[model samples]
Target: MKKLVVLLSLTVILSACSAQASTNKDSNKDDKEKVSQSSEKKQTSSDVYVPNPQLTDDRSLLEIGQAFKDDKGVSSLKAIKKVNETYRIGDVELIIHDVKVIEHTPSYSMIDYFHGFTHEETFDFVKANIEIKNTSDQPVYFSPIAILESSTGEHRDWEADIYLEELNGELAANGSKKGNVGFILDHSDKEVEWVKIFTSDLLNEEQKVTNKAQEITIEF
Candidate 1:
């Protein structure tokens, strides 16, 4: 009877150890899966692009433009034209810095944003850097580029702009803003010799037109 009792005790001990080992293995597998899922989430989040990102330092419009190109992995960039012209309407001042023609191949992560513009993986576009300021003591509403027409007869309204820099809309008193505006070209090979910009009418706080809209042309 003593020998039988010892044998039973040993059987129970061995069974408990086996069960514990199995439980530990399952817990370790779950931990590994959780860690792998976390890694995948981090990688996916890093692939997303943020538009109109905040600048870390004071960078020129040209420098900002180059950074944008690099961020998007542009295959080719051609500065087909450069312009340094200023237009003033009523209490608002507008300046055009430069224009660039770029060829870009969108990554899989960027496909959704570029889908509306083109179906091709590789596409071309024209981008313009501009600045606007309100010199009055009161706020005013204005848009620097109401309508953009390329020399190849392709036209895009302000609503179609890809660069959502929030450069349009109400301008605070003595406030200034600068950014880029880009439009996809219908034909990548088409030559762009010039682009005509139509500015929106300057409106006061009462929504009354203080100044008529103007047309400005920039040649490459």
Candidate 2:
């Protein structure tokens, strides 16, 4: 009888050990699956692109540009020009921080926006980092680049701006805005040597022009 009891106890201990081991194995698998799902979710979120991101920080803009380039397989052969030039038209101040030309082949998701500007699968565009400030004590209407003319004789109006940060229109008193403005070039492969920016006339609350428009040029 004692021998039978010993054998039964050994069997029960083995079964318990086996059950614990199986539970541990199942738990590890669940943990791994959860981790994989989380990773996939993060990757999917990052893959979504925003063309007209409302961002003011320069670093964020650079990251967004990098993400766009990566997503669209874009490239740039020319070096970026750093033009830290500032122009003051009456109470409004405009600053151009940098400019670069990029060749982009929009992905299928981005075709809608690019189709409005170009029919080609691949094209080149110019992007400029800029800042505008209303330095007066009252509100005013202004546009940093009402017209953008390239040295290659290509002209683009404010309506063609792809960045669309709302940098144009009314600015509050002593308020400032900083962001990027981009335009698709007509000649996709042409080299741009310089660009001339025509700013809109400063207007008062009555919508009357209080200050004349200004023309500024930047060399690349």
Candidate 3:
């Protein structure tokens, strides 16, 4: 009888130890699952790249070479990228980009109050952030870039533009960087409806041909 009693106690102890071990394993699994979930949430929050949208088809920037035709100011066709889908029509080369239309807006700062307002204007300025990927092997300098508006098809005509005046940014060959590109949208010119942008240095001179040249619609 004593032997049977001892055997029963041994069996109970073995079963109890197994139950405790199983409980510990289950607890550890739950802790690991919670930690995994927390880590996943943090990783998701880190991956947001919100680029400005108004960079689509910047016609004005494309025309920087045309508006200011001097060799120095003219953005060389050699310097622009191939993704722009352009061909040489005469001596002019068209540079293009896909811009996100983020703000078709009016100047709402204290600066706008110097004149007077009539109504909520139809976007006088366009602003966008662009990712400039330098596909060339050499680096190039930039001017306070101008935003150009395209008149359809491939033509480098300077449209409504807002000159940045001081654009001395650098780009690494085969590397990528991001910067802002914009245009002065004129409420008066219907040609300024949609825009294209290009960057250039001011030391470059403009080729003088009048028609689609920049007109002072609004000075900001």
In order of appearance, the predictions have TM-scores of: 0.68, 0.68, 0.30
Q: lDDT per residue, candidate 1, 81-141, as tens digits?
A: 5576678989988877667766667656677888876798887777777767677888676
Candidate 2: residue pairs that collide:
none
lDDT of 2 by residue, 30-143 (tens): 344344444321122122233443221222223223434445444443536767767888887787777777666776666777777778877777878776666677866667
Q: What overall lDDT goes with each candidate model?
A: 0.62, 0.62, 0.30
Q: For model 3, give the 10-residue run with minimal summed lDDT.
A: 210-219
Q: In model 3, what is the error at residue 128, expressed in angstroms?
A: 5.3
Q: Clashes in model 1: which pairs?
A: none
| 10 residues in a row with least lDDT, candidate 1 | 54-63
Candidate 2 deviant stretches above 4 angstroms: 1-68, 77-79
